[model samples]
Target: MIALLPLAVILPMIGAGVTMVASRRPRVQRALSVTALAAQLAVALIMLVVVDDRGPMVMHIGGWSAPFGITLVADRLAAFMLVVSTIVTLAVLIYSISQGRDDEEEDGTNSETPTSIFHPTFLILATGVSNAFLAGDLFNLFVSFEILLTASYVLLTLGGTTERLRAGAPYIVVSLLSSLIFLSGVAMVYAATGTVNLADLATKIDSVPPGIKATIAAILLTAFGVKAAVFPMSAWLPDSYPTAPAPVTAVFAGLLTKVGVYAIIRVQTLLFPGMFTTVLMVAAGATMLVGILGAIVQPGIKRMLSFTLVSHIGYMLFGVAIGSEAGVAAAIYYVAHHILVQTALFLGAGLIERVAGSTVLARLGGLAAAAPVLAVLFFIPAMNLAGVPPFSGFLGKVGLFEAALEGSTGAAQVLPLVIVCLGTLTSLLTLYAIVRVWGRAFWRPVPQAGEEHPPTGPLDPRGDHPMTTQYTESRRRAREAARRRMAAAEAARLPLGMVGATTAVVTVGLVLTVGAGPIYGLAERAAGNLMDQQTYVRAVMDTPADGAADLLIDPPGLSPAEPTAQDPGGTG
Candidate 1:
């Protein structure tokens, strides 16, 4: 079973090479990509089952042993993330293929178009995401980020339109800055402890001075916060994500930020336990309030959803801030829930664009009557995202709130309690924001000729509100252009494959809600394993301390506590 660990990371990379080689054959590339993702999902599920039955699984590359050779570890958290992420990537791939087919059919374009690059880059992206989850060392995790970021740059700028290039430029600059910080942090960790292995660092971090440890933690957290789009550092997300192709945007919004959140979870829990609770809690409250406020004022669907995405991340950070077993478990559950629901919503938004020819609320109307199926698809996920009752979103948030209340006491609990109230307010505001979109874009009657659609005014981020005539006129012209586009799109037929992929994603979101009980149970176990950090350290180092061998069987010829050549005190 240990051998299977590398396969999950390697198979997608192989698939990427094959797809690139077969770039001229669209059918072959599509088939190969789908097969690769399917196999990846299977491997992930098998790993999940194995890890659940047994414990964490570890693989040492090139027989060099831990702290020297590369290592891959799959605990319950890694396995679960792998399965969920693979499912999302596969769905998005199908949607993208359908989209490409539709574009070629409509435009009469040749096979050599930019769409040819999508499959290989997407596969490479999946491989990077898998590698990040399974990586056992800080340097390896940095490599994974670089892999995904390189692919993402291509995906973001695939069309090379002025808008996409503009968005991609800022995204690239921000990502590179974050990577630099991550690399610097890795170097510092190595210089301080003489080992980059996460398990080794876990044991050695305590010996470092408190000030240096705090500085390292701050640098690392800042880098990850930029990636995760936490408040004060999240202004880039809404502007950057809305310009990409719908499929690209969907996967980016769904999977990318969560990877950062996952890193924060691992770093906080494993590397620096109980270090910065107050700071995280304060950030959580600000993220929730600011994000929802931004969402409330956006006029575009994708931008609004993007802000909501940032807002809901606060919920996960809130869980991490609590720093308890239940808190971490709730966070794990919420992360899984958010990934599915956000992907579904974005895919549904794509379908809406296909039918309405625009995502601006002012230009879209009567969708409930013209495209009831698309409306249903959009409505379910929108409600789920807003934390509607009996949905996974609600359950996840409830779990987090409960955990926050239970995990702290007295004055230590005051901030979390305040954040909980603020979270509830954020939830209500989220519902209002989505419902506003639905009411204007779906429930309202289509505007007649010369009806003069009402203006909602510019989305003021600073709360200064005076509507300018020039701004209103610009909005009117945009709406008129959108109307013309919608008129043209009305003649085109919607693709069944695209709709089917969207429907499947939405159904998966529903499944999360229905299976919340069993899923949350799994999250609890994953969190339990995370809190018992010694178990992970032992598994990776092959050192079972004092009868710990009975809990998990290590591979043969793997010596326990082998000292590294670089640092005599470093534990393998």
Candidate 2:
């Protein structure tokens, strides 16, 4: 398990390179993708157990102690990320493979599904994601971004349709620009401190003037803000995500934006921990307000989900801004829950789009009757995503609220109070949006001869024609079909494996919520790790870089005035 830790990060990369070369051969490409992902899953699982049994493991690549050569470290937090990311990718990749004809998709034989191109890019994308999670230095992290972003550019424009081209172009450009900004931040920090390793930088950062530190942080945040979709910075998200195929959209929504959030969390805690509390507080507030508002205005199925993605970014930041162990723990739990829920929800919508033939509310109808089990799958995450009680979302948010309340001393609690209120408001608004979808698409009657061309029903005196008794007949049919079509769809439709795989993902989502106890504790531990830099440092530190004073941020549990060298951040 110890030796396998380093190999886990490197092996998928080898697979990515191989997939890229063999992409022209469909069979070889699919084999490569499956082999690589399965290998990763194995490594991640092994590492998970190893961490549980033996604690964290650290690796200095090329066997040259830290500071001189790049290091790839895996502590509980890093290992946890690896395990979660690999599992998500495995499931998503399996869904993709099942979705289309393997042979035809690999070679683009029919021109409708290109398996060859997707296999390589998707594998490469997963490799990049895993690398990013394991990266211990700034430059390597940037390299991971490039790998993933390049693969995404390929995936986004895979089909080459005009609507896709429109969406793909902006995504590519924005991502490229963010990369440039991130690279620039790396250069600035390097010039100032002479090392790109995170632990080295932590010890060195304080020697630099506060103003310069803030500038570097601002530049880095700009890049991550764009990536993470933090409020005003997220204009590109909703416009681009829904344009891809269901598999591609699901992975992008699940991983890419969250990576940005991860970066934001890492950067705030590592380089500029001193300023994190205030900066994150403001961003969290605005991110929540703006994201929910965007969802409120959007009318399409995927677009609303996209905006909800934007709003939820604030939840992670809330944990960060709160700057307490409990808050960070909640953020960690939220991350794990949100990743599963969001992916499952998007796939559910994809199923709806497949049957109802549109993601827009106006074009969709009577699907609850058409596919009833599909209704349950789609509805559970919708409720959970909105933070409904007894689900993961509510569980995560309740923790966040506790963190916020505890962070304040009565008077400062006003901001937290407002945050809780806004979280509730966000939930209410999200419920309104999803319910609006249900009313229009599921409950309302299927179109009659004349109503096919007309709006489903007459406008009321108030100009609002909401779901009413008109749905009684449709509701009855919806229930029956919901029970029947679930098995029927998977049992019948042989062409779209995406359909079956999506159904399976929904089952997994339910399981995650039901088993949230162990998962929640893991997240809390991760948050605790994140807030305390020394633990991560001691885990990753080899020969400390000379510029130590400028970079150090004490880990969460330690007192600011009394840092111990043998503590988590110290050199072994």
Candidate 3:
């Protein structure tokens, strides 16, 4: 099983190559991609069970030991993240496959030209995600980010439509900037501690000056904050994501930002414990408020969901800010929950777009009467995201609030209290946004031309208000556009594969609710190990020289403070 740890990343890479070779055969490519992700998910689930019961496992690469060779460590947190992430990628892949086949069948040709790259690039992206989850060193983590971000560029601009290209340009620029920042931070980290291995740094970083340590931490956090789409840094996301293909948008919404959160959690817990609590708390509140505020005003489902996506990130950031086992535990569970729910909502949005011909609230209506299954799909995740009771979202939020209130203590109770209030406000606002979308996009009558009052202005010389003339003309244009979209979409049938994949994801989200006890227990245990520096450091650095023994079974002999021959001067 320890040896199989690397396979989580390897299988996907291998599949990417194989799928690329078989691209001429679309069916073969799809089969290979699905098979690869399924295998990766199996590996991830096995690791989750193994690490939870047996403690962390460390596999040194190429027979070389840690702090020198590449390392892959799977503790409860990494394993759990891997499991959730693979589930999402797999479901999205299936959805994408169905969408592609349906499009070709509808048009009787490959309307989406150059479709060959999609499968391979998608698998590579999966590989990158898996690598990131298991990466035991800073450099490898950076490499993983590059792998995924590069693949995303291709996925985002698929078909090279002008709209997609426009969206991808800023996305590319922002991504490149974030990558540069992350790379610089990695360099600074190495310059400070002479090691990029996370476990090794966990011990060595303390010896660095306080000023330098703080600078390094802040630099890394800023880069990760950008990737996670934390407020102020998040402006690029809503514009950038909504233009991609449905599966592309769904997967990006679900997995990419969470990876940034995962990095923040790993670094904060392992390298610099309790260092930026105040900053994180303040950021969490601002992100929640700003994100939801943007959400309520959006008239489109995709954009609204995108804003809510940014807003919910605040909840996870808040959990990390609380810095307690319970707080971190709740954050972990919420990350998993949000991944599933958000993906389902985006896929559901895709369905609504297919059925109604548009996601714009004014152009969409009466979906419940036409497609009740689609309505249910969208509704479940929407309510779950808004933290409605009895759902995993609600359970996760309650856990976070309980943790915050319980941990609130002398002289600093005010911050937690204030954040709690803001979080509660954010929740209500999120619910409001969801309800507005539900009412406008689902319950209202299907929009029809000539529903508005007749113009009595320039277009109709009897009009009293000139502004009304302009408003009426714009409405006329919008209605016409909606009609065209509907006319085109009317001939397309809803693909069962797409619906089934979304249902599977939504069902998994429900499972998080039904089995919240055991899952939260896993999260709690993962958080405990995360907060304990020794568990991770020992697993990575203290292994036996022969290295045949299971890391979980044999404790490392060397102390964290001592320098190995690998670092003769302790300043590599």
* Residue 404 Cα positional deviation in candidate 3, in Å, after optimal superposition: 1.1
Q: lDDT: which is higher, 1 or 2? A: 1
Using TM-score as the measure, the top candidate is 3
Q: Work out the TM-score per prediction.
A: 0.90, 0.85, 0.92
Q: Rate the local accuracy (lDDT) of all candidates.
A: 0.86, 0.76, 0.88
Ranking by TM-score: 3, 1, 2
* Root-mean-square deviation of every model: 7.1, 7.0, 5.5
Ranking by lDDT: 3, 1, 2
- Sequence-dependent TM-score of model 3: 0.92
lDDT of 2 by residue, 1-572 (tens): 44665677667778777877886776687777778888988998787666644445666666656666777766666677777777777777777676666435456453434776777788789878888877888898999899999999988877889988899888988999999999999999999999888878888998998888889988988898898888778889899999888778888888898888777778778777757567677788788888888887776889989889889989888887887788878887787777778888888787776665567775566677667777887888888888888888889899998988884787778887888788778778888877887787777765443233343768678765465555555555555554453344434333356656666666666666788887777777776666778767766663233222212334435565554553454432
lDDT of 1 by residue, 220-305 (tens): 88888888999988988999998888898999999999999999998999998888889998999999999999999998999999
Worst 10 residues of 1 by lDDT: 545-554
Which pairs clash inside model 3? 456-463, 457-463, 542-556
